[model samples]
Target: CQELPLIPEQDSRDIEVVCNLYESLLTLQRQGINGIWARIIKNAFAPLFNKEFDYVAGNPPWVNWESLPENYRQDTKPLWQEHGLFPHGGMDTILGKGKKDISMLMTYVAMDKYLKKGGKLGFLITQSVFKTAGAGQGFRRFRLGSGEHIQVQHVDDMVELQPFEGASNRTSVV
Candidate 1:
């Protein structure tokens, strides 16, 4: 029952499986048949297995709106409204108003919908999650055994900062 927020990179029209399949085909052509087939199989089966581990972790993407395609912007607009997070020109633009990581929001959504009662979720979020006004407050309220309850254990700064500077900054835990 793990629910994840879908963020469109371009238009909502580009968010379909058809586009993904086409992307896959293009990728496979470039990587050769074997590499492509392996990816296909992996994608097909990866969602069916539940991997058990003590902790769930990862850094989420930090892409803002300007970096996203127009379709994605339109698609996410309602999500921002529904969550009461202001919608701006693009994701990065919204950052100016102090929004938290989409990954942190997604992590909470997953726990609310998927994690069994008493199951724990530990995610690394941006400083914004702890410091922002509206978004952070909303997150805290949700964790305070409020609506659809989830709990927070601990939050720590990344002692090492190098992992945050690469092309995959979004991979940061949030």
Candidate 2:
């Protein structure tokens, strides 16, 4: 498929559109031997099925904290706090510390839930996540709870390459 329809939550219209697109693609015999082996999960953070893999990779959404829906923010606030991604309080919150991209949380959750020991994960995330002082401090800490830590093996800065069309955000592969 040229593109996978991304509906963060269940929406009948979106699902129908995706199904129709798939059907059209399948009619053209585009699918391989495995056919269309895909699971459109309702939620990535709280997945219904669970499994650990040796490797995981993704380009999580780059929504800022203020852009998130109020309900969603409220619901996931506990998880963010538990993961130490949420800002402490007072000056931290006022200064927008740890309130930048949601991708950081997504990265944390993906590694915490899906990756096995000795596993490696690659994520294409905003470069500001590393350079900003207050924004990604928690993420830079590299702690994954229960005394577990992730060793960042590599980082490839792609800011100068301008790989994406019509996108100005600085990106990096980690």
C-alpha lDDT values of all predictions: 0.52, 0.76
- Give the residue spans of candidate 2 off by over 4 A: 1-40, 43-49
User: How well is each residue in 1-174 modelled by candidate 1, as lDDT tens digits?
Assistant: 012245566645535655666677777788765323534755665675445444455544455534555565575555544553442336644556444456544555456444667766666556655666555565555552224544556666663664556633322243
Q: Which candidate is the best by TM-score?
A: 2
Question: Each prediction's TM-score against the native?
Answer: 0.50, 0.73
Residue 86, model 2, lDDT: 61
Q: How many clashes in candidate 1?
A: 18
Q: Model 1 lDDT vs. the true structure?
A: 0.52
Kindly give the number of clashing pairs for every candidate: 18, 0
Model 1 bad stretches (over 4 Å): 1-55, 77-95, 98-100, 143-146, 159-174
Backbone clash total for model 2 is 0
How far is each candidate from the true structure, as Cα RMSD in Å?
A: 11.8, 9.9
